[model samples]
Target: MLRTIFLSLCLSLPVLLPAASFAQQKSWSGTAEPRNEKEWIRAVQLRVNANAVNSFMTNRLAGTGRAKGVAALTVEIASDGQIKAVSIRTSSGSEEVDESLRRGVMALPQMPRFTPDMQGDSIALVIPFALHG
Candidate 1:
């Protein structure tokens, strides 16, 4: 009976290990939670979309872009939501495309700001820009 039980457990171990690792990975991923102050991330996204239209970046992209790949940036924001610094973590391969994205980021106006209780000294964001025809 002891050997039979041990064999059954060993067979199940392989199946359980992948599931355990997946759950662990999902938890560690820095996804946003709908906490009060943290909501600024959403606001920033919306503002970026709106601000993109008719801006200097419009000329840089040349035409309607269909989102080829994603780029990344590390942005430092003060407790007041003012951007302290902007650093590009990953490039979109083309210098023109990367510079266009940079211009768009620099054009963003001061946000509505965050309260003192907000966590984190800064946040890293992934920006996906489309590829033009």
Candidate 2:
């Protein structure tokens, strides 16, 4: 009985293994070009977007004794055109205003495109968010 049970367990162990282990993994080894015009374009666009949102937020707080300096916000937008994550990369010595701005941008509409930063089929991009008074 012990040997039968052991043999049965051994036979079923293979079946119990995860399907992922046997499945082929998709390759993400695409080429990337970090330094190029596309990167500059992406950076400019991100800066523009960030500044626009910040300006709108500042306008809303007008006449409320708001003092503005500068802040660097970091936002990650996924390929699906959604703000996946947002955080204040550098605060202008004011957490309250930084948090407000971050929330404001997060609430904005999704960016229209995920334009690839590329050179000869390789692609890379760094989108930055900058706000200034």
Candidate 3:
């Protein structure tokens, strides 16, 4: 059987900042740490695409009964672009799916290095993945 899966990306910042501040900034160039929520979202979207989590989940879930739910994950990325850790803030109602999502994120390669402007050795982001079939 052929299964269809749709992946949606939603990012939640650790600290809520004024939208006006982000709106006034120039677009992120993908070279340094993201300066605002929008830029950070863009960076995360790029990393998700590079990691191919959608495809990974599709393949991983093939022949399985579980396919639809939302999983919220907390990811910590080091200044050097390495993924320091990944934890599930909310599960997708299935251990299989949750584990698969975690594995998919953990497979991500090095991301953009954080700039001094960011002021942190590592950053934690709450990313929600919506999976639908």
Clashes of each: 1, 0, 0
Residue-level lDDT of model 1, residues 4-106, one tens digit each, is: 0011110110111222222222121233433464455555554444443323235545444522354554445554556566556566565665565566556
Per-residue lDDT of 6-85 in model 2, one digit per residue for the tens? Answer: 01110110112232211121221222322444443343244325443444455554334442555555555554335566
Q: Pick the candidate with the highest TM-score.
A: 3
* Superior candidate under TM-score, 2 versus 3: 3
Q: Could you tell me which 10 consecutive residues in candidate 3 have the lowest summed lDDT?
A: 12-21
TM-score of each: 0.55, 0.46, 0.64
Please state the error at residue 7 of candidate 1 in Å: 44
TM-score of 3: 0.64
The pairs that clash in candidate 3 are: none
Shift of residue 74 alpha carbon in model 2, Å = 0.4
On lDDT, the stronger of 1 and 3 is 3
